[model samples]
Target chain A: MQAVEYFEVECPEALGGEYYKQIANDVLLDHNLLKVIDKLHIFIDPKVPVFVAVGLLKKISTRVRVGDFANVNPLEGKMTLVISDETYLASMLKIFWERFGKEKVEQPDRFTVILYNVPATPKEIEDIVVGDPSESLHKDLIYALRCIAPEGFRLRSEIFTGTKFTFVASENTLAEDIDTLVAEKFRLMGEVPP
Target chain B: MTLVPVTYKGGIFQHDIVVDLIEDLGGYIVQKHIIAQEVVLQCFVPREDIELIRQISRPLFGEVTDSPLVGTEIAIVSMSLEIHHLPHPSCDIAEYVRRLGAKSNMVSLARGPGKRIAGLNDEERDVINEHDIAVYLMGNFETCIEYKMPTLRRGIEVPIVLCGGPDKEVLERIIDPPVEGYVGNVGRFMRRTKEADELAKLDEIIDEITRVLEKKREEIAKDPLSVYPARLMGLIREQIPEILDVTSPTPLTVQIAGLRVKLPYDTFAERVKKVAIEDGITLGEVAEVLPSRMRDYVIVKVLPFSETNIAV
Candidate 1:
């Protein structure tokens, strides 16, 4: 789709290519995996009864940090945190309790948490990471590829790199040289992910 | 007399005579429901005498429309109830068929997943055979469909219509032994069919089903059943009062051959076998009350005139 930077579906016949493009578009959109993918290439060889899919993911930079959700004030004896977003507050509190003692980290109100006798500076506290979007990118990419693969193609081999992924599926067992086949699909798109 | 199915939509007033009229014309009342002050009746009447019912109902502000799909049940089958196939197209087709007053159900297979592994066992086939017709929801790729359909269609005695992504011509050429119809653009669906073009695809499936069902009705009419399923349903409901105690949507599901009574087969088979029509001929003598594959229901398939030599 136009949402992705580059998309191509190669099939033995033009009809299958056209129909599979629509199917892939619907499936990827249904899984909400379209925006995360930057480039994709799909090759369906029905005679060989194999489906290969490879894609390049966009740089996901959204990592929720302490400073992003709350304002930190360094008091005389304690550090005060005014929580603005509560979505990741639980995870943040879990991390705080592990770094400091459970008794020292106290939540006095729903939106205010105080730490007594904290050793770290405000800058170090603000840099504490709470949530990262790229952690689940591989799982989501594999799931989307599985949905796009033909129904009976259950046997699968998947490889996910930092910003690239490849999925190969077939009804039959994977052949001895399946990685070479997957690499060939990536070659169709001008780059073979290693 | 050829029977023409019709549905009556009007107020509750003057509805008693409608049943009497159908019985007098050697027809049968399929279903009737009175809610609030309105009444809806589904019945079949002699084709030549259908106008008489319309004429008699004019004064009561009743409208009678031909409902060919009445008294027949259809099954909307999907490979599985997974998110890929269910709710969108299978439920959509079933809802569309029900809109025309036919009874429809959604059936999901347990073992029909992979292309090479897509298959239906005898129990699944029997469940599908319970319906008058079946519409199978299929995938987009022709190659996968080619490998999968033969396995899926095996042992399915009832007529099957395929909903997939290939054009009708392409499907007709690829699939062997030809199904009832093939509708493209109904492949995997992510959204409900709300737009004009999307709904038009649903209409295409409905139109195809109607055509095949109409043709099936004609074939079954050649050597007609000794009794009307509508009348048998009425008789079963009247004699076996326990039938009404069931909680299913439709206690009795009418089909091309006969009716499916939603009661345990082992307990009610003997009682249903004794439901008599006009003469001393009980249901067991004229029909086969067999166990249904779906749960513990019973299906009654009345013998044709050639077998019973009796017509009412």
Candidate 2:
């Protein structure tokens, strides 16, 4: 069986460092992957109670295309979207409705939706604006990524977008060289370079 | 030879006491068995030496140092509608007692059978008296235990331990002839705990039961049997081969002096008479075989050889 890597992150300002740590520990233990040499970092910004957890994405099968998650077809005038993964269909539709108001959205089936007047490239639709990005949104995205990542990975990095903020998590900060400047700041916090 | 019932693992302490007490009294164990419940069934000492064995075991009585709740057979008297809660206390107490090497049970009184009506029923009364100890689990209200006392007031000469959620003092004040004592903290319905503090209360209950059994041992010694059951069983086994094949519900019952052997009334009498010793004296020559008083079973009692002037 292919090993799955899992990680979790939270913005301390939105959820708190202790909460993310508890969630991380719980998830890691539940998955029986605590011993893996994955680097997990929880970042707490002094300006706000922002906490972010970042870890590496360890396992991925190149054979399974991303289109398996949702249908990608280039149509004239706009790109059409059809989802085959029924489980994520609701969330995808919710995102679609938030970006394109309910009046403009059309759902023909449980797992099928059409985004009107969209670019041929589906990645552009993925980048469509829904809700304004906030610290909580970044934390939520990290949490979702942690839920999706395979279990074996140890290193990860999380970046906060507000004020051009960035957070990176990895197995070894010293070996990976995330940022020499950032390492100095972390060194002052008594964090040994790994 | 006598039959001593011992508990396994957790009951090691009590098992030692019972073994020592039996051997020290010059009583031999004819049969040994393990009883899972708090009450044990023992057939010890011949009919003639029952009083002696009782006397020897008297000193070990009433040491309730162990949890009063240990070895207690609780009857969760509740309605059919409340059957879900039956397992709650039984599992809780059973798990607690298991740690101490004891056992408990949760018995449900028949539906439409309140305490008063059920208390008067012969079957219910017999079951209540059958156990060495009983716990009458009541509801939260004081009146529940009070009103239910009448149903539980059968000929239960053994300890009747009470348990409910109410404060111990409040229950004591409300129960008129008050039960042995009320156990508390049985009301909390929550997750299982492995913490020592969580089990302390149950330990206290087990201690109470041990104390009560000890006291009973004292009272039983007041008038001991002449010959213990152990000696009688040995004599019966040596003399009667038919007993081995004669299967009755309770094949061996611990009597005051000798154990009672229940065999089929019609078929085994002749074979029982044919059992003889090396010198060729038959069992019929020493013991009397007559119809049992309570059931369609034969009752055998040892008659002194001197009385019959026979030696095998």
Candidate 3:
């Protein structure tokens, strides 16, 4: 029941309600945002020259680790890794090459990686972090928000959190009540403002 | 229904034959330009006789294609040529208009963004007025659209078609005195329009242009000029051999009322005015020859026979 895949974009009555929904959908898909975000609400008031976007990010529990992406088998002094997901293979190889030097790490096939000098415990490779999706999500969300905002709305104030992000942008001077307005928009979208 | 637009591209050697054939078919040449050894003529052939013009083009090593809006010019006006106003919906619409055979000019103004600074200057207005119809792409808010109408109303004299992202009702409510037409579903589109809805919107804009142009054509028929703009262009090219040396792709551009000769107004204005036509009549007698608004070039507005009191 908590997992409501709700995404809504609202424009001021002056700007025409639901007018920018397609544009919002386009910008979201263009940035490949459908994979990470579960709910999004965008509010635009052309009269105030303000654009606000609030999104709820789906939880990414752990970083991409070497053990999750590859199978490491140690035999003698060398170790072989048969990768399952190539998405983190480059990062995993970078870390392996850094520790064992370039000459020791060899990838002959797309999925097989061989290390000449294996450490005492081959399972130690399991704890190595390849990448974090949440970190990149923060970056990509801002990008998607930029594409949806008005062209003249250059000044932006973004509030980024672990699970949610709220961005407010405007061309003119930010009035003192901008925070209130953003909160009001979030409330309208059924979001408990942070 | 009277004139059907067509484009002919062929070699320069036998181009005159094609031109004569088009003339014999009761067709008029809107624009003629020589690109290297090749010549391209945009024409308005009689709708019923378009097939005859096509047949003549076949023997002349020419390619003839339908260009519906060839004889007319349209201006797509926006505040800036930057990422906001251009290369998106405006450029997309302009390209669409070009495909329909009308000459589309993208008019970008300096300081054209922000409600406080978005207004056209005299030079910009002159450039827009040169076109047959001006399409002003308004913004979202009705109040903003209303605020900007005065600048366009004061500067533009030709028919105007207001286009925006809002509904037709919203756009109509804001515009005063009623423009020639109002087209909705066109604005600052960041991406291309390939969807069914967006394509339908483009069709609507083209329909508005057709309606507005039809009205203007009827008005022109009521009080027709002594010479058509295309005919006047042909006369200028023949009488003034010096125009060939100008080297501009389009030394003379045909307009609704007259033509704009791309020559310095001071030196060439008098020569253009003195051009003698077949009737042993000077251009100055049937036209108001003066300097253009954008540049020093001459702007010739051929007067109606009722005004000049001489029927051609």
Candidate 4:
């Protein structure tokens, strides 16, 4: 298996080369995907009016458990969660309210949540999933790729997986030859076909 | 005499006094946006009478600020009204210009997509020419923008501003004749415009548009229009009360040479032509009333003193 490496953009159309690279970088930065993307490659041909992007995402094995963002402590009759990252506070409170009862969940401050009469242990509470970053990361990746694609290249096809993604867009209806073109493009980037 | 465009912002209470004062001063209210409690009136008041209107508005706790493009109309052109080209950036540009006080009309060309096949026809060009300035929102490619410019310049007489997604350097090299200015970073966008950088680019387009209008203003000053289009618009409103029934925004829409009354042409053209001024001279003698390019709206083109042998 080939290990993921770097990000690059190639344009046969001289004028679009630097412009495409700059925007593609911006879109990546905007989505905070620089860390998650191990390697990304984009190729554009303005004359043919085609846009293609292929990337390998760093694997994320763990879900965003409550413990990663908050400190869950078990009290005598209540469980108190002191959230370190306020980003997941709303979802954490909702999960507690749903799993326990709305009456059992009380938040006095912005980042502290207390739950009363909780049967679950600290480990169990800590195991509660707040969200999966990969889901939204995938979505943001697609959005960023779309932003980089030229506006008139409406016809699109995308393949998304746990660790890899490929998107190809064109002004015309994509033909079978496009797959061959994509393969040739990947070959140029020294990406071995699956 | 130069007319200044002013925006009056204040409480809605006793706002009619301000409106009445502007009307009495021969100023036309281009547009007024009123919520439950606040009102904003965009007015084109004569330079000599600006201080008078300001004094009235000041005592009423209303702020009067200059709105340079108040009565002017701008056409925001795009390739098509379809999902591919319309919403993302064109609508945002139109909304921004409208906020700046110009009456912005969104003009989408019939066959303005695909660089090889894109071309704008005469009618589309005429519609664009009617505005004080034309803003053509173009795509990323240099070749395509260069290809599209000739058709726009050939048919439209108004100054054109090319706004596109590419870098200014790339656009400047390609864009030629009839293009007043080139504004970059405004083309096809994927999301609702919120970025400060994107907004700054829109502001640049607005500034270029203002510059274009100023150039046209300087040219018009050489031999000014028969009457200030706004003043004529105000007169038409006062003389023809029937226009009040027209529900369109700015029923008496003003252009550089004339005004387009958004009333049915066949029934109202004769009445509009027969509108009399203070001299007992009818509009028919000083202007030509014809069917407008838009729906059945009547177009009143005020002839110059050289043509009509009458000056307002």
Candidate 5:
């Protein structure tokens, strides 16, 4: 019935477990990460002073590229790109300057950009990958996890792949087997440790 | 005179009459303000004459209700300013108590999280004790709240009203002294307390606070102070013209049992003690003027009749 397919919280204290589940749901929903997370499992040990969270992310089918957010047109040896979405404009400009140099790229206005004497065709420019939603999603997802974690659990260890993530936090230094704890949580969610 | 605390809210029409009536009856008008078209008055009137005060306000389209918090300062205590306990229930509790005529201060403890490593220092405890009472905003877990609270509550010397997530009956069942100062369902808001249920819970918390304040009033009534705090506010302002220059909006902030004079204690403590009252007795003869732990302000705690053998 919920957007997320699976969400589970495990703790020694029953009330603490229920409260943490509510907190996790609220934090994820507030951060707009509920839909993108397919499964989430959290394990908290107040006595042991550890909190572990493991989550499986939904498959991101759409890869944002230059063509997806801008219109490309060939004019002589140069190409002009008129951006329709500016959410990734800053990152796009950074990539352009790094790849084609500032001398070859010129942004005249907010949405207009001109490439001069580029060897690549307009189609090649359109194919350039500029935005990765998963990259920012990982950051936001980790932030929401921290919000869900117990207060004063400042020490953190995080692992974020394109399709999976595991976050461990503690008031003291994290345990040496923090990965095992995360793997145990992932296993609770019916996922392989890998 | 049996002073009964109350508040009034209605139109501005004939509101001056109510003020005049309170003054004529020798009652105190603690605070009165006009917010746009409406006027709000928080005052204390003679107990037997309360009906008369209400009757005079009826024609002004105003209502008078008993609310002991009208002239007191309250502290809303939380674990810390961390994401766990701040800007949610702390803000909500402070706003609710302030809306009901009490001066509410949000007091966030410096290290008031985690059961083993959490505790409040002497200064933090004193700051919270400066108010009439403290309302502790805690998290959702029942066991954690019970176990972790005493550490955060260390050295605090004031009545504490708790607001948390666990059901009141359950909390009262477990906590010693039978927890009359517990309000539930107001824990850790993801948003503002704008929803009807959230506001209802806030109202419940305020009602609990009023009950606690009324209890304090009853205790004070047993051995009444020689001079009421509100009366001293006027005397302090009149005799000590220097207080008028003080930047605090309320130079003599009203507490349930005393007053917090904003003047520096080192220079003004002796001067405040020498303030003369009725019957040829100096203020020092009937009250204990102590250097307040809060900002070195002088605290004028009027002696009870049992101690001073005088009552006004």
Candidate 6:
């Protein structure tokens, strides 16, 4: 496929523009294409420590939740969901069992499950779960991206869900000020700050 | 006389050089090739031959050059960028070079290891050849390094060392012009040495490269530079105002006695003359500022007309 877009950021002075360039070039030149897009969408977060470039991949989403990802419908006042793709099966099951209790959810098929007495609002059900599944989603996405990115990229990413979920990937050069770096990079790219 | 039956599994850029070094130091290449599968077996002769084999194979196997890419120590750049393991062949070679008191670069061809592997691009080839010396690690059992002769066989101006896992005879016979040298080892896929033992082998390789580098240093001593690069850097900083904006800390560094100014040659040549010492001697009057042989940086060398004719 043709490269539809290209983005780059001038790293902050703390990140050493030259040093960041070396790492960026190393990652860009070495990334694997079969699993992930080699080209990056980069922007400098001025709020970040100098010499760091925060990157985002637009239009590429690998998030899977119970109702958000698969078909969830009501039957006899209960929710019968058929998850064709069990991307977050473990987290989904954990959330389901914790909210509905282990006896309330039954799995007849490998990818299909039935939930009884589930709340009408999926958001309400999502909230009942003690731990946030979005964290794991972010981690999975980061792991996938790392497997796809070049070795030199040394990527560190954080995924979050509010109205919409965002996946942020960055080179791990800035150990302490990663959040600032990422925010600044997003601002530099004109992305709305979290 | 002593053949250590050294084996290297993967393919590298300077495999030929390693083979040549092994033979020159009195080691015979036992078996060599790119490792296609996960495992392979090799046999060794008497332990007495180990020294001769090691001496010959030492230069072939250990680190021999200072790697400009990774500044501190030698590290192997594996063929598959995904794999991260200890005793990384590229890192092993890099350490080998460092032990010899020279820098080493672990280079992986753009295409991963295989018989149909691609050669280095122009930029990559230039970087690989830029080293004072290079150790190319090739694949084990696979013929990618040899078959892709056009990639590595191009005339290398400096010593291009080579290493692989097959018998030395295979490398000698297959390589078109043949590499500078070759070393045998278990295939790249197979972990040859236990953690501690592998480190010991790496240390041995480093020792061999040090000896070679020492000899090279002696040869270079015949004619010393009138001025060292660091001295010129200080002089240029004091003399030139425009150099401050160049950005490189080690700006106006030297490669073989000539100064390499990080400033753009085309834009800065005329402006550089503004730099003058307290004695009113301008840089232009003492040295010729021109484009570098390799990059866009300005190359400066003292001309015979300079008051200080000898490099201080």
**Candidate 1 lDDT by residue in tens digits, A73-100:** 9989899999998988999999999999
Chain A TM-scores, one per candidate? 0.76, 0.33, 0.81, 0.87, 0.74, 0.40
lDDT of 3 at B214: 74
Ranking by DockQ: 5, 1, 3, 4, 6, 2
Best by lDDT: 1
TM-score of 6: 0.40
- Writing each residue's lDDT as its tens digit, candidate 3 over B28-112 gives 8877778999998898777888677667767778988875567677888876776555566788888888767677878877756
Cα error of candidate 6 at position B166, Å: 3.2
Question: Global CA lDDT of candidate 1, please?
Answer: 0.84
DockQ-based CAPRI category assigned to the predicted complex of candidate 3: incorrect
Residues forming the 10-long window of minimal summed lDDT in candidate 5 chain A? A13-22
What is the iRMSD in Å for candidate 2? 23.1
Flag the better candidate by lDDT, 1 or 5: 1
TM-scores, in order shown?
A: 0.84, 0.39, 0.74, 0.74, 0.84, 0.40
Chain B alone, candidate 3, TM-score of 0.86
Can you write out model 6's per-residue Cα lDDT over A137-183, one digit (the tens) per residue?
A: 34444444443232333434554443222334333454665567556
Off by over 4 Å in 1: A65-129, B7-65
Candidate 6: count of backbone clashes, pairs at least 3 residues apart or interchain: 87
Instruction: Give the lDDT of residue A189 in candidate 1.
Output: 77
On residues B15-38, what C-alpha lDDT tens digit does candidate 4 reach at each position?
999999888877778778897899
Query: Which residue segments of model 5 deviate by more than 4 Å?
Result: A61-131, B12-14, B173-180, B242-249
Off by over 4 Å in 4: A1-7, A12-39, A56-148, A154-167, A172-181, A188-190, B82-86, B152-154, B191-196
Candidate 2 second chain TM: 0.53
Error of 1 at B115 (Å): 3.0
Better of 5 and 6 by lDDT: 5
> Could you tell which candidate, 5 or 6, scores higher by TM-score?
5
Please give me the DockQ of candidate 1 compared with the native complex: 0.36
